[model samples]
Target chain A: MDSIEIPKRIETINSFKAQGGKVAAVLPIHYSRALFRAFDILPVEVWGPPEVEASYGGVHLQAYVCSIVHNALSFLKKGGLEIADFILVPHACDSLQGLGSILLDFVKPTQTVAPLYLPRGKRTEDKQFLADEFRALARQLSNLTGKEPGDDKLLECIEREEQADLLLADLYRNRTGLGLDNLSFYRLIRSREYLPAEQFTELAQTALEKHSARNPNGIPILLSGIVPERMEVLKAIEELGGFVVADDFACCGRRLYPKGNERDPFLRMAERIINAPPDPTRGNSIDERAEFLINLAQTYGAKGVIFYELKFCEPELFDLPNLRNSLKQAGLNSVHIEVDIKDPLSNQVITRIGAFLEILE
Target chain B: MDKIVALGIDVGSTTVKMVGVNASGDFEWNYLEGSDPRVEDQVDSFLQRFRTETGMTDSVPLVATGYGRKLVGQAEKIVTEITCHAKGVFKQLGHGGTLIDIGGQDSKVIIIGEEGQVVDFAMNDKCAAGTGRFLENTAGRLRVPLDQMGEVAIAARDEVAISSTCTVFAESEIISLIAHGVKVEPILKGLHRSLIIRVVAMVRSIGLIPPLMLSGGVVKNPAIRKMIEEESGEPVILPEQPQLMGAYGAALIAQKIAVG
Candidate 1:
C-alpha cells in the first residue's frame, strides 16, 4: 500500500468553514459529536496543542492547573481558537469543570460557551443523567444554530458517529497486521478529533483496506494516560524495542464506544459513551478500569502497561496507584511516566520506558 | 585477556566509560574520562586509544548505553543505563536482587529477577534531589570535598535536619544554617541524611528486595552505602568497579553479537 495520505486538521477546518458550517471547539475526553452534527456544527477537539506560551492563561489559572487548561485558555486569549463559533467544555474533571466555569463566568471569549455535565459511574441513573445532559446541550445548540433538529435527524447523526467509531475500533483490531509505524497509526487515530464522521469513516476504511502484511516486532505494551503530548516518547518506546499494541488514552483509545441500545437518540448517545472503555476522568471505579485494562492486555498480548500522562491531570493521577497495584496483582507489570506538555520528552522518560521494556523482555 | 572479543561504551552525562570483555565474559580492560560535549569525537578518540593500548587488530562489536548513547553512531546497539547496570551487576555478582544506582544526574532502583532479567525498575524524576548532584550542590556550600563528604558525614553523631529536598534550596538552607552557627559536621551529616531519605522514598515505593545491591559513581561514597543499608536494614552488596557497570554491561551485551 502507498503511504496513506491523512487529512490535515487546518485544511479540514478551512474546508468545513468554507461550506458555511459552524465549528464547536471540544475540550478533552467525552462529548456528543453526533449532537453537534445534528445542528450542522463540526466538533474540533482541543488538547493543549502543545508548546503554546501559556502566559496569558497562566495569569488567570492557578500555577497547578494542567497544561491542557493552561494552554487552551492561553490559546483562546491569543485568538488561536477564533475559528470556533462555540466552545464545548465538558466536565471531564475538576480542572475542566473550572475551565468551563471560568469561561462562562469570567474571561468570556467571543465564542459562545456550551458546558456539558458528564455523569460518574455506569449505573442506570448515570446513563439517564447523561442523556438528560445531552438533551439540554442539544437545546442549547439548537438555540445557537436557531434550528431545533428533530429527534429523527439527531438519531441519524448519532448513527453516523456510531459507524465511524466501529471502524475506528476495527482499525485498532487490525493494527498489528496493518504494519503502520506508531506515529502514523496515532496520526490516523487522532484524525477523528477534527474529521467529519463520513470523512473519518472514509479515512479509516482506506487505512483498513490498505493494511499491509508484516511480522510486527518489539515487546507489545498498553498505553494509558490523559494524552501523549510529547511524540518523542512513542519514538523512544519503538527504538527501545517496545510496541504499543493498545492504548487507553483520553484523546484516543478510551473513546472507543460500542453501539448503544436505546430508542431515544440522546439516551443512545449517552449509553454508547457510558459503555465505552472505562476512563479515569469518567469516574469509573478502579476495579472497572483495571478489569478493562487487564482484558485489553490479554486480548492484545501486551506484557506491560505504560501510564504516559501529562502533569497535574488529577483524574489520571487519582486512580493510578490502585490501578497499578491491580495490574501487578494480575501479573501484568506497569510503569507511570508523568511529563509537562511544554517540555520535549526527556531522557528520564525515555530511560523509564526503555527500562520498562527491558522488564517486559 | 583470552582475546578481547566485545566492547561496551556508556556515554553518560558526567562521564564516558568503555569496557572490553573476553570470550569467557571476563572484563579484559576499561577506559574512563569526563563526558565531553562532542561525544562522537570523544568516542572516536577513545576507540583509537583502545586500539593502540590493547594492540588488537580484531574488530569487536560495540554496544553503547547512556543518555548520550544515541550520539554513538558507530555502536551496533544502544541500551539504557537501567538494563546495562542490571546486566553488569548480575553478571559480576551472580545473583538477582534489588539494585540502586545513584549517578550524578539520575538515580535508579532496579529489581533484578533471579534469572538476571529486569523485573521492575524506577528512575528519579527530572528533579536532582535524589541524585549525586544534590549532595554535590550542598557539599559545595559547606566547603566539603566530594570524596571526603561521606567520611565527615558518617562520623558526625549529632546530625542536623536538612529539610530542603531541592538541591538549590538546600544550599540556601545551608547558608541559613551556617548563619545560625550550626556545626558543620552535623549539617554535613544532615545533608547526607536528606539525600538518603529521598532515595529511600523511592525504595519504599517499589518495596525493598533483599540483598540490596549498589552501583554507579555514588556507590563509591561510603556514607551513602552505609546510610542506605541502615535505612533499609539490608546489607549492601558491591560489584568491583561499580562505576564501570553500565559500560561493562554494554560490553557483555556486545559479546552475544561477537560470538554469533
Candidate 2:
C-alpha cells in the first residue's frame, strides 16, 4: 500500500466532516468502540507518518518507549493530531502513560487524561474496582460534554459491539477445521487495517466462503506477539502464505471491548475480558514460557509460529528469549521479527520474512 | 593453604567485573571487561585469566549480580541489583550510608539505615536519561572520546545548563550549542552537570543522606562525581572500581556461605 493511503483516508474523513459530520480521531488499540460511539464520536485511528525523517530535537525517551507512542507523537508534531477533539488513554502499557502525560501537559492541553486502571486481581474486588473506575470516567465525560452516560445507553453500545465481535469470532471458528494455510490467513488480517470493521467482516465472511469451496491445505499456525504498529508488516507475512490463526495481543485482530449489564456494563465488560480464554498471563498451564509455547504449538496442532516483537516493549522482549527457546525445543519452525511501528515497512523485515517463509515451505 | 576461592561476577550492561577473595580474607580482582563483546566468552576467558594470574586451580564458589546476572551459570546465589548494591555500598560506607549507582541501563539511589537494613530506595529503570548509557550515547553523538569527555567538562570556563531531560534532545542541544559559538568545554561541563541535576532529583525523591558511596562505571568520571557532590552539596565516597560493587557483594555472600 502507498504510504499516503492512510493520510488520504484521514483527509477524506476530514472532508466528510467539512460537510458537517463530526470526526474524532482515536488510537483504537486499547479503547472501547462502544464508549466512543456512545459519545457520538467518530473513531478514526491515529497512526505514525507513512514516512519518517530524522527529527533533530525529539526528546530522548527510554530505549523501551513504544514505537506507537513515538509515531503518534511525531504525527502530532506534524499537525496530524488536529482531528481529535479528545483522546482516551488506557494504562495498558507504560509508554502510553508517559505519552498521555506529554500530550496533555505540553502538546495538547485539551486532550483528556482518563487514566484507565486495569484490574489487578482475579476476584469480585477487581470487577468492582474496574466498574467504579469506568463509571467515574463516564461521569467525567458526561460532565464535560453534558451527555448523560446512562446505563441503558452503555448496555445498548455493548450489545452492538458484541455483535461485531461475535461475527468475527464465528469467522475464526469457521477456518479452524478447514485446514487452511497460515499465509492466506494473515492477508485477511492485513485487510482489516485498510477496510473498516464492517467491510473487513464482510471480506472475512467472503474468504471463508472461498475456503469452504477449496480443498484442505496447510497446518494451523498461531501468530502471537505485541500489536503491530503498521499493517504493512503483517501484509508481508500474509504474502508469504503464513496464516495468523489467533493472537493474545492487545491491539488489532481482537474483539472490541465487551460491555457489562444494564446497571453495570463496565463490570460485565471487565468480567468478559478477564475470562477470555487463552489469556496471555495464564493461558498455558506451564509457568516456563518456552514450555508454554511448545505445548501451545503442539496442542493447537500448529506446524509453524511467528512471533512479532515490538521494539522497546520490554515485557515482550523479556518474554521472547524463553519463548524462542521453547519453540526451538519443540522442533517447531518459528521466526522472530523485531519491528518498530514508526519504521514499520522496512525492506529489511520484508526480506527476512520472505527468506523465513521460503525455508518453512 | 586451603583451595577455597569465592568469586563474585557482576555482568553489567556496560562492563563486567569479577573479584576473587581467597580463604585468607584477601581479595584479588580478576576478569574485567571494558566495552567488550563476547561477554559470556569474556567471563570464561576471565576465569582462565584468574587461574593464570593467581596460579590457583581451585573450584570457585560463585555469586553473580547485575542485569545479566541470571546468565552467569556458575553462581551459587544470584541476587537482585538493589540488594547487591546495598550490600556493596554498606560495606564501603558502613551502616547508615546512602548509595547512588548509575549503570549503563538504569540508575538507583539506595538508603541503608542503622544495622544495615534497607531503609528506602528509589530506582529510575524506565529510562536511560540519567544513566551511563545516556552519557555514552551523547559522547558518541558529539564525536568526543569517552575518556576525554570528563576532562573536557573539567576544563569548562563557564558551565552552560542543559534543559533537555532526554539524551536524544540533549545531544542535539549540545551540537547546537557548539554550532552557535559556544565553547566545547563548558557545554561538556553543562552536560555532566545536567546528569547530576537529574540524578539529584531522584536522590532527593528517596531522601539523600551522607556518607553516600558512588558506585558504577560512571563514578570513574571525577568531573561528574564532583558535580554530583556539588549538586547534593555533600562529599561522596567512591568504591575502588565502583562498577564491580554488585559482583563483589554477591561474592561476599558466597564467602559467608562457604565459611559457615
Candidate 3:
C-alpha cells in the first residue's frame, strides 16, 4: 500500500482533470461517494495539511475555528483548489458550513459549491429529508457535470462502495492480527479519502490477503478523535510500546458505511447515513457514542482509550465530559489530549502520551 | 546528610527545579533557579552542583519532568508535569484529590484517584491568562513587585471588574483603569480574581474532587490561594515547597525505579 504514494493519487486526479474530467473537493466525515462516482467526478477529501502558514483563513474565519477549516480556507486562498471544478461541503459541523459560505461569497466566488444536509436522526421524516437532499445534490451534480446518472449507475457505485466498506470492516476486525503497525494501517485506510474507490478497493483487497497471525506485542488501546491528522500520535503510541487495536475517529472508524436494506439507491444512501456509527456532530447522544466506544474497546481487547480531540472543536468538546464519565463508569481508563491539525505532534504531546501509557502499564 | 538514592529535575518555562531524595524518597537536598535559555547546559551545571554538594556518584537514577524535560539528556525517564504533580501532591497529602498547578506559562487542574494516579486533567490552552506570567506581566506594568502584588491585592477593600482574561489585553485594561483613577489595590484584586476564576473553571471542567490541592510557583501568591478557596468553596491544600512538586514526584519515581 505504501507503494501507492499521495503524489501518484494527485497525479491521477490531475491527469483526469487534464483530460476534461471534473474534480470536486469534499470535506471529511460522511459524504455519499456514489453520487460523484456515478457522475464520473473525481472526489478529493480535504484534511488539513500537516504544516500551513495561514494567510487569509486566520483573518477571515473566527480565531477559534479548528485548523482543518482554517487550512482548507488557506488552501482555497492560495489557489490550491483552483483545479477543483466545484466544492462539496457536507453539513458535518459549524466550521465547515462557515467555510462553505466564505468560499462562495469571497474566495473562489466563481466556483460552484454544494452544501450537503446529512440527516441526524432515525425517524422516517429524517430519512425522507436526507433522500430529498441527496436528490437535490444529484441534480446539482448533474447540472455541473452534464450527466444525470441513472439508478443503475447509482446501484453499481453503491455496490463498489459496499464492497470497499466490507473490506474495510474486515481489515479493522483483524487489524491486530495483521502484522502492520498502527500508522501503516491508518496510512492505508486513510488513502480511501482521496484515491478513487476502485483503486482503493484493489489496494485494500491486496493488503487483506497478506494478513498474518496476531502480533499482540504492546498494550492495546482504542483511539477516538475527530480525525487522525496527527499521524505522529500513532507513531508515538507504537514507539511507546502501545498498539492502536481499534479507533473511532470521525474520518477513520466512524465513517464506515453501514449495509442497508433499501433497494432504491437514494433510500439506501439515506438509510446508510441514518444507521451508521454514532457521531457527535450529528446530535447523537453521548450515551450512544460512549457505549459504541466502550463496545469497540471491549471487542478489540483494548486496555484503555485515548480521546485525541482537535482543539476548539465544539461538537467533540461538548461530548467529551459525558463520554469520559461514561467510560469511567464502565471502568475504562481514558486520557484526553487536544490536538492541533497544523502541529499534529509536538514534544509536549509525546511526553503526555508517554506518561499516559505509563499509567496504563 | 543521607546518601542520594535518586535525582529529579524539572526544567520549567520560568524556573528549573532539582531534588535529591534518599532511599525513603525524602527530599534530602534541592536546587531551584531561574531557567536559562540553554537548558542542556543549565541541567549539566545543576548535576555538577548536586554531585559537588552531596558527593554522590553519577549512577543515581534520574527522572525529568516539566516543559523542558526532553532537554535533559541524562534523565533515565521523562514524565509530564501532570503525572509528576499528582504523584508528588498525593504522596505529600496522603490522599487523592483535585490538584491545580498554576505554572509560569500554563495552569492545570488534575483529578487524582485513590492510587495516586491521574484520573483526568485539563490545562490552559495556548494562553498566558490565569498563570503566573499573567500577574507577572501586569505587575511589571503596574510597577509592583511580584511578591508584593499579592499582598496588595489581598488588602483591597473593593474589586474592579476586569473583563479581559487575556494577559496582554488585561495589561491594557489595567492601564485604562489607572487612568480612570481606579486604585491599585482594587485593580490588583480584580486581576487575582480573574486568574482564580479561570483556574476554577478548569477545576470544575475536570469535576473538582474534595480536598483541592495547589502546587506550582503561583501557589506562593497568597491572593491566588485565597481567591481560589473563596470561589470554589473548598480550602486549598498546599504542599511544602509547592513549586518543587514536579521534581519531588520525579524523585519519588526515580526512587521506585532504583529500588526495583
Candidate 4:
C-alpha cells in the first residue's frame, strides 16, 4: 500500500464517520489510543494546522501560548474540527491543559471533551493515580461510545498497537539500512499518529521488509526536540550532508513502548506511559533526559546533537542549559534552534544548521 | 599596505557593516552604513566603493552574517550572528566568557567556551524591547538624538521608572510621562534601565559567566554600558569597534577557510 497522504487520512476518517463511526480529535503526546480503537472510535491526532490565522484563539488564549495550542484553538474556531465527534485533550502540557478548560467552558461548551490527566511523577501513588486515571478514561470512552469494550476486544486492540510499536522499533533500529532520508523516515513513522493501528502496522511492516543496504554517508547527528513539525529542518540537514540517525521527539521516536504482558489492559497502557522516554514535562529530571540523549548519540555514533526547541515551550527551555552542559561534558557539540509551527525554516536558521554541519565536518 | 586576505559583510536589520582582514587576521579596513530597503544594491555599492578605494579584488573570500546575510549572493558562506559574535569577541578579548550582544532588532546572551565556541545562548524572542530598537523608538519620541541618548540619560538627577518592556507600549508610556511633566533625562534613564533589565534577565537565564563582554551597536550608548555594569555587577569589556564584530568574525572565519 502507498503511504497515506494527510488529506487521504482525513477523507478516510470522514468516510468512517459517514458510515456511523465516531471520531475523536486528540491533541499531541500521550493518550491511550487503544481504548479509542476498541470503542470503535478513530483517534485523530492534532498538532495544529500548518498555517494558522488566529482570530478567535488569541482572544481566548494568552499571547505567550505556544503556537501548537493557538493553532489548534484556531482550527476549532474555524470549524475545521467539525467532523470530530468529540475532542480529547491530554494533560500533556500547560498549554494543552488550558486548552481543555477553554474548550469545556467556552469554545465548544456543548461538545464532548475528555481530558486525560496522565500522572507526571514516579511515586507509588503516582502509579495508582495513573492507573485510576486510565480506568476513568476508559469509563469515559465507554460512555461516549455507548459500548463497554469486552476483554477480548481490548486485548486485540492492545496486541495490534504492540505489533505496530515493534515494527516502529525495528524501523528505527535499521534506519540507516532503510535508505530513507530524515524527512521520509519521520513522515512514515508519524503516519501512525493518525492511521488506524492495523493500517499503520501494515505500512511499517512493508517499509521494514523493503530496507535497502545503502548508508546515508553523512555526518550522523541525534535530533532532540518536542515534535518534528518543521520538515524543512530535516531537509536542510540532509542538504548540508548531515543525517539524523536517532531522535527523541515527544510525538515520534520517544513514544514507542516495549512489549508488556500485564493482564489488565488499562494497567498495561499506564505502565507503558510511565516507562516511556524521559520527557521534561513528564517529570523526568534534566540529568536523566540528558543522559538518555547522550547514550543514544553514543550508540548511534552521532557526532553532535541538534536541539529543535519549540518557541515558548517552558519545559524544554528550562532543561536546555543543563542539557547542553551535559552534552558538552559527554564530548558532543550541540546547537539549539527555536522554531514556531506556523513559520517555515528561515534562512538564518538554515545558515546556523549549515555552520553547525561545517563544524562537525 | 596590508593585503586583504578575506572579506566579511554583516547585513544587519538597522545597518550594513563590512570588513576586510589581512592574512594575519588583523582588521585592515571596514565600512558601516544604514541598511537600505534594497539590500542587494547596497551590497553592490559597498563592494564597488571598496574596490575603488582600496583596489581589492573580488577574488577574496567573502563570508556573510546577520538577518540579511542570505541576500548576499557573493558570500561563500553564511553564518549566524551568535557564532560570529563569539568568534569576534574571543579574538578581541583573547578569552571566552559570557557575551551579550544587543543589536538593532534583537538581543542575545551567548556563552562562549574557552576555545571561542558558542557553548549556549539565549535571545529575545519575537520581541524588540530588549534591543537597540527599543531605545531608538523612545529616543525618537523624546526628540533626543540617537547619539545623545546616553549623555542625556546620564545627566538625570532622579530616574523615573518606565514600566513597560515593550517598544510600542513604552512609547505610549513616554507620552504619558511627558504629559505628566516628567523630565526627559529621567525618562531616558528609566528607558535605559528597562532595556537593561530585560537584557540582564536573558543574561541570568543563561547563567552569567565572567568576564562579561558587550558588543553590537547599542554598546555605543554610555548609559547602556554603565547600567549594564551596574545591573550585571560585572565589568563590561568591549571590542574596539563593537559594531563591526559580526563582520570581523565573519572575516576571521573566511581567513581560516582560505588558509586551510
| Candidate achieving the largest TM-score | 1
In candidate 1 chain B, where is summed lDDT lowest over 10 consecutive residues? Answer: B118-127
State the lDDT of candidate 3 residue by residue for B1-260, as single tens digits: 88789999999999999998989888899999999989889989999999888887768999999999878988999888888999888888889999999999888888898999988777874789868999999999899999999999998999998999789999999999999998899999999999999999888877888989999999888998999999999998899989999999999999999988
Q: lDDT of candidate 1? A: 0.89
lDDT of 2 by residue, A1-361 (tens): 1111122455555664675534445553444556655655555655444455414115634555766667667666766667666666665566767766776676764446456666644578876776676677677666556677676777777676666666556556565544344434444544443234454556555655554444443434666665654666655566555555565454443333333443567776666555543323322222444554566566556667767767776556666656665666667766666776656475445544543453355
Q: In candidate 2 chain B, where is summed lDDT lowest over 10 consecutive residues?
A: B22-31
Task: Give residue B91's error in model 1 in angstroms.
Answer: 1.6
User: Which residue pairs clash in candidate 3?
Assistant: none
Q: Against the hidden true structure, what lDDT does model 2 obtain?
A: 0.64
Name the regions of candidate 1 deviating beyond 4 angstroms: none
TM-score of 4: 0.91
Candidate structures ordered by DockQ, highest first: 1, 3, 4, 2
Given candidate 3, what's the lDDT at residue B177? 93
* lDDT of candidate 4 over A1-361, digit per residue (tens): 2233333567769777877778889997887778788888988988876577766689998988888898899988888788887788988889999999999888764458989887878776776787788788788877777889877888788888888898988888988888787888888888887888788888777787877877677999998888877776788889878999999888887798776667888777777778888987778998899889988898889999988888898878888888898888888989888888878877657766776776677
Give the per-residue Cα lDDT of candidate 3 at B58.
60
The deviation in Å at residue B41 for candidate 2 is: 42
Task: Report lDDT per candidate.
Answer: 0.89, 0.64, 0.86, 0.85
TM-score of each prediction: 0.96, 0.50, 0.94, 0.91
Tens-place lDDT per residue, model 4, B117-215, is: 887777774688988999999999999999999999989888999888679999999999999999899999999999999999989977898999999
DockQ of every predicted complex: 0.68, 0.01, 0.49, 0.32
Docking class of 4: acceptable
Q: What is the lDDT of residue B184 in candidate 1?
A: 89
